[model samples]
Target: MNKIFSLLTLLFMLIYLPSQANDFKAVYELAGRHFPWLKGKVDINPLENKKQGDAFTIEVVQNRLKIEATSTSAASRALDWYVKHYAHQSISHMGNQIKNVSKLPLTNGKISQSSFVPYRYALNYCTINYSFSFYTWEDWEKELDWMALNGVNIMLAPVGTEMVWYNTLIKLGYSDQEAKAFIPGPAYTAWWLMGNLEGWGGPISNEMMQQQVTLQKKILARMDELGIEPILQGFYGMVPHDLKKKIADADVIDQGNWVFTEFKRPGIIVPTNKQFENVADVYYDELKKLYGSDIKYFGGEPFHEGGKTAGVDVPKVAQAVQTSMQKHFPNSTWVLQGWQNNPSDKILAGLKKENTLIIELFGENTNNWERRKGYNQTSFIWSNVSNFGEKNGLYGRLQRFIDEVYRAKNSEFGSSLKGVGIIPEGINNNPLAYDLMLDLAWHAEKPNLDKWIEDYTVYRYGKRNPKVVAAWKEFIHTVYNSPVDENGKVLYQEGPSESVFCARPSLKVNPVSSWGTRKRFYDIERFKKAVAVFISASKDFKGSETFETDKVDFLRQVMSDKADLAYSNMVKAIEGKDQETIKSSSSRFIQMLKDQDELLQSNSYFTLNRWLNQATQFGKGLPDAKLAMYNAKAQITFWGPDNNPKTTLRDYAHKEWGGLLSSLYLDRWNLFVERALAGQTVPPAEFYQMEVEWSKKADLYKPAKSNKKNLARIQQDILK
Candidate 1:
């Protein structure tokens, strides 16, 4: 009996303990790095059945805490649970919600928890550029820790794809300079990977590419330590648009213009062509040499966003792409974005169903998963693109997220539902949106909103003040509310309500970005009431970073709403020929913008200086610091191909940051006011020129020197 038990223990260690992929000791070291007090006070033990799926337990034995978890990811989550439920402290993308304690709190008993799913995924390809474009190793260190604590085991880390492409292009008979031309700048890699446009933001310096490659190495090392599997950008027949100009042998299809006629999309090499597999082989070989051969997932979207597929044999091409991927990384899963008709019926018909995973993108507004019958029984993650262009506004389909997730989990195709994920185009805003969605992976049934949100508030704001808690409850039904149809699908909303303040000033301004909603969907009065209550509790959380950051965020929303009202009144006055009303309202509107800029200074995260500074800082050792700066400015303003004024994507990534609000956005609105008062048509050409000029300016555009008011005073002023 003793011999049999010992053999069973040895088998269990070999089967379930991830001592090779990631060690339990590393999780202890990670905890030590984060909280110094936890260095000698905790022990992390590995479980014996991780194949049964991820789970964790917390207990205290003779004062020292113990965490028994199936994997490093689960252990990290267990620590996070202890911190939130017992210690009453938590960390988030925004900031830490912490308070001084006499001693570390322990669980009441052996509290155990388990996840129903095997994957907890995070990030969209665009998130790499939108939120982390300028991130140094220091920034990624924190970001990875946050991800691990949140139980995200699968992440998209397609940074440094330029290096892989550069080498592949060079091997395929291109000069060094020519190869570099194919790679985009740091700010434009997302679209380049999606094959939308190539070389638009480019020719990133060779030194910068190497730095990013090294950065990715470090990123991967940390992810491995924390049990995160990275999804890399796979080669799916996309080559540089100009590649056909040089390589006349291969048949390359012209994808024509992307969003605008100015930027040409990359050409696709049909799988039937001899060079298709040849290019893919070189691409993957270069990828393996640089990044390592342990990768198990690849992300590539063919025919994404209206790319031409006329001549391509859709099914054959799909099969060829997957075959090449499998040849490179055996047993790997192909991660496809189920957006619109992508991974279409033709594409799905050719693949090995068991090895494919579709991220059901646009879950906030679309039901492509159910409509297509669980993506035709292929495994998929129920996901949401909560924000677009990293824009700021409070929005989330709170209840509908729960409803839709469970609705799918209980459906006939439930076995195909593998997990949950957040694929926001930009992930810089709305922590609750990401946190709540990710949290659902651990539960088997619908979470009690009242209980979950109350706990969320506690961890989100250290010790939650009653006023703040009450305000959040109201917030649930207001800005965070999702009006669903009888089938549990939300009414169409493309991300949050676009701020009227960010829009290029016009009497007919609907949304700041193209393809965004023209109407505000929630009750303005209820939202204001919540904000006021949130502010009332500020006195208790005076020095808290989380509280202060939220203060800036909440107040920004109020000012944006106020700006809309001011703009509307001015537009009415101008039409009625009420000269006095027009002058007063216009002047007040400009003043409101000035006040908004000042209010944004309360949080550095909400400031333009931080973004621009990161850009210039990233370019410190590079040949030209100005190029990075130009990319940063261009992304937010003109979003350029330099000379194109008719580009529809202007102000698509418009930020409501401090320095930017006062400068470029202010100047645009000021011009509109001047034109409105004079009854002159505000020339769109003139505004585009201003945007062009702003993008070209060498100045860093730091915040103005002013007597900044307290957040409370700013709130009052915004209300008035």
Candidate 2:
């Protein structure tokens, strides 16, 4: 009997070992694709389940990495451990590679660490449209790898939702044209999915719809293999506003337009109607046919962001939605975005407390979880949206990230807090902010900013230099620690202060966007000193990409700051009635913009050409390629339906990028300056015309990289 038991155990081991090994193949494949340097040097083994949170260990022998972890996600963290600690390399925000260590550090014994938190979530609804609307498969591969390495296990994955909507509508007897007209283009899908606006950015091509479905399968497959749970779009009774016209008997409410009247938002179907469950079944059935039924989370919001709910019974609709979701995806958690009075008391009253999760959308600015009683006793995830509209800026409430997550976990409702998340609207800037936020998931104790920044500087630039350290310290104290006015109940505000340099030339430019603030709460002079110190370190570390990027970045900030002074002079010239002064001041302002644009050309990260190019690539070799390019540019500039001449969304997604400065902003400046020089009120009509015309230009712009020697010379001049 003992021999028979041993033979049975041997058979069980043979069956289980490959499944465990397969869990890590995605991580190795990711390393092979992105970090080829660590190809044969990494080995990962699965650890048995334990009482503690997800744990990992790394033992370095010679140069090889032996990683042991509870799962594939923990193994990725272990790989990050070797890369950050043993290899002294960094894969920063926007996937910037900073490498310098020639050899991996030898370890005497295994180094082990365990996470205090179980879930690390990432992404915002706006992030889908703002940052990744144009992403292809290659882009998603790198992104999934980044999420794995950063230990993000739960992410909002709505890439192919357009196709899901299209297929479902067609199955319900709607024509192809009707389906296409209801779905928005790539850039506007987020708002459409949120029931904000529909059919604004597009009449999506059938080919593109099919392409998205195929792409999402690949994304879901890779995410599954990497141990990340994808939160897909769920059916929440939203129907196209025109569905009633098509179906004749459809029980759709006439939900009005969202923010802009020209853009019609989707209508809602009453959940009590017998047809509602039938339509929902078709939607989820179509979803499973295309994407499979292995999903663990479903995310959708009913009446999101002030949608009209006049005829709907809030709790009954909520209950019906949850019931349908559970029926389709058994035991799946419903992930809701806790933004601006969402998950209202009535809605919360209808949910199954154990199977629902709310993402506290603005943890850096508000304490919604505490104020709302842990979302009325339902589980919640603490998340920060530090950036908005993918705007260019260097700002974050750093200490808030450290304090709030810790405080929440210790609060009266701590037991209901499920995880921590980074839900930035745009994620191209503020690398350190994201790095620190993700690290909080694993750190058992509150981190000392002083010690953490010291280590960050070393890993960032591959060495510790006092000049760099001093600069970062000032950054932490000032821009990084800038205060928020929590007393004010402001919602829908634009991101961090917009750079005056990027604004349309105006003396009274209160803010760049309609809802943004122009206030600088920190000491500008100290920030300048910080920039100077970072620039001065170039002579010591010119070969470092991190240093080079920071040099261009600091110079950009210094120039942006100088714009305030330039605008002041321009206003003074107008007041004094001096044409030459006005001309000189305007000329100086334009020159400053031109000079900054040239300086920004030194780094590809700061180039507008890259953004436009990436956006255009979404429709490569397709008939709608030009239309896609037009959508890309229009979304960034005059986010339009130019039918209304008095739209307020102009410059809402403005970029401080290089090519845009030279072409778009430069043209706007020259026109504004010329009109001012001629003593005429600014021509809003002409400026709008210029913007619309610029969006139509099919000319591809690729700024040549300034030579390294020239970049070095320019860096020195900017610093001095």
Candidate 3:
């Protein structure tokens, strides 16, 4: 009997213990589907070692590159490894332009490398809303491919979660109308998930909601095949504010409003309540039915971003939530965003350290992981969120990222520091920042920045121009390498110091966003010199799209930075009642706007129409298309209902994109200049009114294309 039982156990192990598919079929299929350009050039095959973490071997034999890995994502990353190191290429979160070299670099033998991190991750809650709320399957395919290439094996994939919530709510004894009322629209779902506000940007069409579920199915399948782990939204006791009305016996807390506003937040279902288990069962049952049973990571923040925790035992409630998750998906990791005062100590005590992953969200501005002791010994990822709301700006503390990630890896809490991640609110700017952060996953120690950048410039523009290299070095010292004082206070403004041109007309121009400062942290003349150097190489690199794009961007900043000096003169003229001088200063400021618009139009990455068109196109053929356009415009602009001028959230997601600078910002400045000249009161009412009208329009604007010569001419004109 014992011999028979041993034989049966061995058979069971063979059937079940191999958790991973351990094949390149799925990966090869993904490559053929998404990046068909790489079909004949690259080939993937499985490595024999199944127990090892995602590792790969790359070799170029007879011009056919064979990549062997433990998994498909590993294989994909191996391809990226070759592209980045051998071919002198870069694929970043900001832009996707991999140079196709006709001649391949010769690889000696099989070159092997393994991931230092168990998990490489991406995205922020704001990222979903700011950048990807309008993503189609094609958009998602490209993004997932980029993620895999960047070695992002675990990502927050919460697309169509609103629909899941809607479906689950209906199953749990709620009417369809109640369910629809509970769900926020596409643009505002991120905050809704965070328990910030509920039902704000809604009246979501059924068509749109259904479309999301279908889209999510594809996203999940692709992610699974690519070896990228999809972190789904877990049940964390957030229910519709009207949950009590729908489920009479539901023990829910009425979290009043978010950020001292009249905006109602979703109700928190008390976790200790026996009803919590029942609701969770229903929720997870639906989750598994919709997505699948293979999910290994779950993300949900209880009492996120200042959500109320009154009348409950914090630790016990946390325990209950985790218990529910573990009960449904045994041994699954619970992911938490390490934002301000989040995943409180009391809550952390309740969680099992091994199963919890904390994302240190604001690594650019604050070192929460280091301060919080790695969330009291729970596993954490050091993340860099250099951009917010996909706001257009060229800024990042690159050296700080390298220093901190190295420190964390070598610190006393190094064992608990699991990985590095890029959690940008928007992932479209500062390509160098993302590449450097992700590169941390490969190196055990700090990479020589000077040497790394030399290679980066080569990959960025195909060949190294001495002037271009000097410019980048200057950028690294001035913008990317910000100085910090004692107590970790950076001697720099937060979130891309607002350009004076983008600010509301005032004698004293403060930052556009509340937490931001108008202080110019770096030397303006030094930054200008860097831009001049880059433009000088435009003749040599005129054919390179990457070079031209970056050149135009540099010129745009040069024009924007000069606006402060012009604004200062304008203020002096206004104070002296000198109409002629005021007109002259105002004319210069207006000219700067025109130049910026033209420069930005030269690249799709910098164009305002890219964002607006994507948002509007999402609501195409729907009755509420106009409403969708309004939501998109409002998110990037006023960011609140017109009733609240004093709302702090307004302008938090502001962008200085091309069309916006040309239209909305220009109109505001034009009105301000006229009022100042006429000695009329310049209240914000007219500008606000104009903004509302602008948001209502759905007209498309084509981005004007300009060549490198044109860009260089413009740069010279601006600088001169």
Model 3 regions more than 4 Å off: 1-22, 29-38, 48-52, 93-102, 486-489, 704-713
Q: Among these predicted structures, which one has the highest lDDT?
A: 1
Note the Cα lDDT for every prediction shown. Answer: 0.84, 0.81, 0.79
TM-score of each candidate?
0.95, 0.95, 0.93
Residue 369 in candidate 1 has what lDDT?
A: 90
lDDT of 3 by residue, 576-670 (tens): 88899989988987887777887888777777788878876787887777767778887877776656666666667777777878877888889
Clashing pairs in 2: 185-202
What TM-score does candidate 1 get on C-alpha atoms? 0.95
Taking the tens digit of each residue's C-alpha lDDT, what string does model 1 give over 7-84? 999998887675542467667776776766676788888776644999999987776779889889999988888888
